[model samples]
Structures are given as structure tokens and as C-alpha cells.
Target: MKFLKILEKRKSIREYKSKKLSDSHFDLIDSLSNNLPNAVKNQGLEVNIFKDGSIISEKLDGIIGYHGIMIKAPHYLLIFGDENEVAYKMTGYLGEWLVLKLTKEDIGTCWIDVGANDRLIKEKLNLVSHKSVLGIIALGYPKSDARVSSIYAENDDKLISENRKGYPNTDIEYKDNIVSRRKPIEDIVFLSKWGNKITAEELDTRNYDEVFYYMRLAPSWTNRQPWKFILDGTKIILYIESSEQENNNYELIESGIAMLYFEVAMHGQGIPGYWNLEKLEDEKKYGAPDNYYYIGYYTF
Candidate 1:
């Protein structure tokens, strides 16, 4: 199956086999490294492919003071970005592209955010001031009997806190379900304006099934899925639902990843488009609440 089909087939596999990947697999991965799409064109985003995850894994475990959440794999990918608006978005854009490339190679991956907070890990990647590890991906073949006994979201704020001793609310064990649940399209999507709902059937008739289908599946912190879409004719605007608490940059990164998925799925279905991140002039005219700020628009 193509990468588009693999979108739905892909699940976050926590258990991975210890065997090393073949040379041909790494060759394919290396070929795609230069071809990754950058939200900011020509921006220097670097990725480190660790064939043996031991060095970085040990550092992350030592710094975070926890060993349970970090997944062990034969290889890992770290996307380093300079702290800025464009770099944050590009981090997600390039990182997810690599994730999809690995998926196409039949390699399993799980996004590991907590691992990015380690000072030693960042130093090992040669990240200087203002540049840091944006995200990490655990890469390897999934074990034949791999199953996630439970799923939990790490508190992004606490991950980097100087006072943090361990991650909270991450050890709760649930049932043996392996697949993560996604919110239905109707709950996360709107027609022309916010709070104006429409069913997936409505979108399928308009030839938007592929775009919205994949966008809805984009991963987010804690599965908060803190995003909403506004479909106005041929334009699709992205928004993050408003929050009162201290804001984190991870949401913007996740939105960028979702935009990439939407674009790739469109291309997979023979549609062409690019994202426009410029804030809309009359964004409030669309009935979006004060809490829903514009992220960008997908123009076909």
C-alpha cells in the first residue's frame, strides 16, 4: 500500500524489536533527508539518526529521572530547530515528513517529546543557544507481539521545568487497547465558520475526504487534539482552540504537522496545494471565537 493507505494503518507502536535496520533501509532514509519539506524554505533544520539509541536514551533517562515512558529502539531521529516562530513550525513539518518516510519503509515510529528536554541530549546534538531539539522519533521494527497497554500524554510544561522530578499522570494503566482514539471529523471541523458543524459525508461529497481524513489523525500532546478546521469553499483555514492557561509552543508544532498531513493526503489523491501562514485580515468576521486564533490556510 502507498503512504496514504499507511496513514490509517499506522499506529503508535511502543514495543520494538532490538535488531538493526538493513543498509538498504538506511539508504532510502538518507535519500529522503534532503527532500523534506520546510515550512520556511531553505531554513537549516538538522536531524540526527542514531543507529544505537543507548547513548541518548541513557542521558534522557538520567536527566528526566524516569525510565518508563521513553521507548527503546535500534535508531532514533531528532529534529533540531532554533527557537522562533518559523523554526517551530518547520520542526513539525520536517519531523512528520521523516515519520511518513519511515512508515513507507515499513519502519515503526512513535513521537517522543519528553526525550527532547534533556540538556545532555541537546548538547550531544550540538545545539547551541536558542537552538534545541524540537522533537524525537523512536525508529525500529515493531515487535510481533507489540501492544500498548495504555496511552498517556506528557505534560509539555513540566518536561523542561527545572523543578520537575518526574512526569505526572503518565503512569495510569488502562485496558489492553492498542489503537489511540481520534475525535470524529464533525467534532473538530466546521463549515465556513466556527461552531457550524457538518458531517464527514458532507465533506466526502465535496472531494475533501482525503484532506480532512488525514488531518483529523494528526497526533497532538495528550491527544488534546487542540485544533479546529474551517472549510470555506476551496480554502481550508487552521485554528487552535483558545486557552487561558500558559501557552506552550508544542501546539503550534502539532498544527504544522497536521497541515503537512493534509497537504500530503491531497497530493496522494491528485490534488495540489500549499499552506499560507499569513494571518487573515478579517479572521474575526468568520465567527471564530476570541479563543480560536488563526494558524494558517491551505490554498489549492
Candidate 2:
């Protein structure tokens, strides 16, 4: 449970202290960014760190027409992808890992999904033609008055539901008391097949309690938690819960975030493993219900 303390304290802090980050902080962050796992490992996504905000402010002005979501942090990490589904997922995978690493260092971060001038950011970073900005991560120290209005209470033992509204519009303002809602375990975890609910007693992971718990706490867009897992021995099969909207691009990114969280939790306990996305065709042969689309698998 090395990350347990960090997972408990890692809140998306919108308000930040204006002090600059030291060179050591940037060096540690850069090291983590260089070493962490990504969707495409060797040739994965690229991350750029900006210690200044002048250009960022100009580029982010018209995103939602209000410019109210601007977070005045000393540093911002811009994540670039290859303008493809895998790259987008890699953004989430590597980005979330970097965020956790920062959290472990006692730094605060906020995942900015909207209100970004992605085009301007790409140009500022001088990215190649095929690459684009996936998203940005705001980094700084939390303000003295910053407090998280978490959905889970200190002593509340009840499993919560994942009934949240869709993504917010660009005009959305930052709130101090942000709620961190999570879906009940039965709603996301399956036994052997899709939709097969399992209780904590049936998880079968005798030593993986905290790892699975941290996986449930992974953040997602609009707090949708739009991913599910099917535990089969030491392998965890992933699925992007079907959405009738358009495509599952963003959902795939969220799934990648969840997978990285699981892997990080395992590594915190000295366990070793790697990801395997080559099972897409084989997973389809399993005939998972239409509600669940097979993504890939992570094996130990």
C-alpha cells in the first residue's frame, strides 16, 4: 500500500501556490515521464513541460469563451499524441502515471480536458505534422484553503454508485469542494464473464486487495468510470463499456489510465508485470456481450 497514502491525498487542486518549482522537481518529473509505461512503449507519446504561462494564457483564452478555468500554476505539462486512438490512450496512460508520481512527491495536479487551444499548443511545441495535443496537466502546490469535498468519507464504509452527469461545458467554473465519486465494486468488476457481479469475498486475489482498491480510485473524465474488468487468474481483461454516443476514443484513454493505476499499485508492492494489447481479436472471439467492447489484457 505504498501509494495508499498518496491515493488518499491526491485531489485535483484547481487553486495553486504561485511559487516556482525547483530544478529537482522538474528533474524528477522528467525522469518519471521518460521511464513510465505508455500505450506504445518505445515510440510512445511526447510530454513537454512549460514553466511559463504567458503563451498558455493567450492560447487558452477562447476555449470555452469564459476563460474561467485557467489555473495559475507555476508549471504545466502538455501531452502530445500521434493523432490516432492509440496515441490518445497513451496520453492518458502516461499522463496519469506522471500525475501519480507528482502526487507521491507531495505536488498537486489537475487534469485539464477542455478549455485548451490545442492547435496553438501543438505549434508552440513544434510538433511534427502527425502529432497533436491530447491534453494538459496543471502542476503546483495546493493553496492553504484548498480542501477536497470527497465523495467517500473518512469512516464511511458504504460502497458508492457511479451516477454522474456527462462532461461539462467549457464555461464551467472551478469548484473548491470537488466531489470524487466512485462506482461500487459490483458495478465494475466481473467474475469470469461480462456483467457477472462479484463481491469482495469472490475476488480471489488474496494478496491484491489494495491494488484493486487503488484501481477503483483511478480518475476518469466526468467521473464516468466507463471501464470494466474481468479477472481470470493473473490476467485482467479490459473492456470499454459501450457508449451509444459516438466513438470510444476518450473511453479508451480512461481505460488506459485505469490500467496504469493498477500496474502502479502492483509495483508499489514489489510485483512485476506488463501490458498486452495484442489480444483484441482473441478477446472478440469470446463473444463479450454487446454492452462491453473488448480492449486488451494485462498479464503478470
Candidate 3:
């Protein structure tokens, strides 16, 4: 799918009119949901467009969302997958992929973090025994005046903040309902080695500067964009801050969301590539710092 415009247009919508989706629109989303390619081949993510919103918001009240504050919409895009680090990655990728895709359909989405209590969540949702409820996407036609990520509104935007000028879209006038506060590429991208900042000219020369620019648009947990990219010879390796790498499934899902942005940006530019999730030697292979936890690599 063409992504730049959607990436520019994408942001979480917290408020929605309680009107449920029309049958035609529901059918379209159902088709799209079933056909998506799973990030993990062995365990494909299963998605459902739960038509009745109240069944969940009422049942899962205080069980989902950040801090038990649920963002109630008319419907939800529910994701179910195996309980594993790989599946968590798949959860993020599939969820964000659908979120971005749904943007083109004019449907707004928000990643409502499915909190702890997976057992209760599983029982309430009537999910299969094998797969766990990875996350939920509150979906609907967005209310005209309500567009902010309600769950993340309480967060201090100053944390890991960056000026908008650092991105490729220097047209600062095109601000969305929420001003983008993505981490600068200078702080995230390294040269052929760790701790070496990649110059803009070098990034531009390789046509990769735009990839990083758009990748930052991916929605992350609490707006903590804890993803980093390393230019290792022919390999472009992905890593997250070890400090925030693993804690339950939040960061793991964030890693998968980051993976989607990188892949989407690359493919959006007519470049063909995929993220290899196999472990890369961070310490022995490249002597990366303990702070950088290598997740995977993409050979462009």
C-alpha cells in the first residue's frame, strides 16, 4: 500500500461516536483483516472485527487500556496470537499494519494496550486456548473534534522529544491534531558501527534518510520511541534500548511496530526487504554496548 500520505495522516483517535460500523464497511475491513501477511510465519496472527463494542468495553472495563481507562469506540480490531516473544513482535507488526492500512479507508484507530490479566481477558473475549489477546484497536469513524491519543495524553511529551524540523517533511505548517514529537534520527541512527552518528549527507546518499524519517511516525508505547537502527556493512540491524527492551509484552510489541515502519518505508520507496528476526550477536559480532539490545536485521 502507498504509505507516505497515510503515515502523515495517521494518529490515534481516542473519541468516537457510539455508532457501529455499517455492514458494507465491516465486510471490507473483515476482508482486509483476514488477508494480511503475518510477521511470524509459524504462528500467524488472527484478527477479528468485533462488531459489538459494548461487549468488550463493559466486560473488559479496567482490564484493557493504559491504567484501566478504556477508549470506548463502536467496534474493536482484536488480535489473537501465541504467547511468545516472537508472537508479541507479530502482534505489534500486524496491529500497526492494520492501523496504517485502515487510515486509507478513513477509519481511525488507537492501540489500546491490553494490560496484565490475560487470563481474565481471554475468558471474557472467548478466545481460543492456544492464542492470547495480544492487543486491541479501538476503531470507528473518528469524531471530528476528538483525535488525540487519550491513553497517552497523560504522558510528558518532553521525554525523548525532538524538534519537527529534523524530519524530511520540513513543512512545519502541516501539523496534525497531535504535533509529532518523534525522536530525531541523529539520536537513533548509527553509522557502520555503534556510537558513530550517521551524517545527513551519508544518509541521503544511500536514500535511507527518508526511511528513518517516516519510520519515526510509527505509534509506540507511551510515546516512548525506544527503537534504534545500526548500519552494519550491508545489514541494517534494529535494536531497542535495553533499559526499556523487555517488560511484559509492551516493548516487544513496540519492537514489532517499529519493524512495520521500517519495512513500510523501505517498500514505499520501491526497495524490497524484510526483517530477519533471528538473533544477531550484539556483543561478540559488533561489540555493541550493553544498552543496545539487538532484535533483528534487514538486508537491503
Q: Whose TM-score is greatest here?
A: 3
Better of 1 and 2 by lDDT: 1
Once model 1 is optimally superposed onto the true structure by TM-score, how far is the C-alpha of residue 59 displaced, in angstroms? Answer: 0.8
Question: Model 2, 1-300: lDDT tens per residue?
Answer: 266556555666555778877789989988876766644566457788888754564556435111233544678887776666566667778877777778887787877653234566556545565557776777888778654322111111121221112112222222432223566677777766766777777654545656676777777655567778887777778787766656455576677787787777777766788777665545654457787777678788
TM, every model: 0.80, 0.77, 0.86
TM-score: which is higher, 1 or 3? 3
Number of clashes recorded per candidate: 0, 0, 0
Q: Candidate 3, TM-score vs. the true structure?
A: 0.86
Residue 268 local lDDT, model 2: 71
Clashing pairs in 1: none
Better by lDDT, candidate 3 or 1: 3
lDDT of 3 by residue, 1-300 (tens): 467668777867776887777788888888877687745545657888888888888888767664455667899988888778888888888888788788888887888777556789878878666667887889998888664642232233343244322212112222454435766788889877777888899999988888888888777666667888888767888888655433558777888888988888898887888888887645356557887677788876
lDDT of 3 at 29: 85
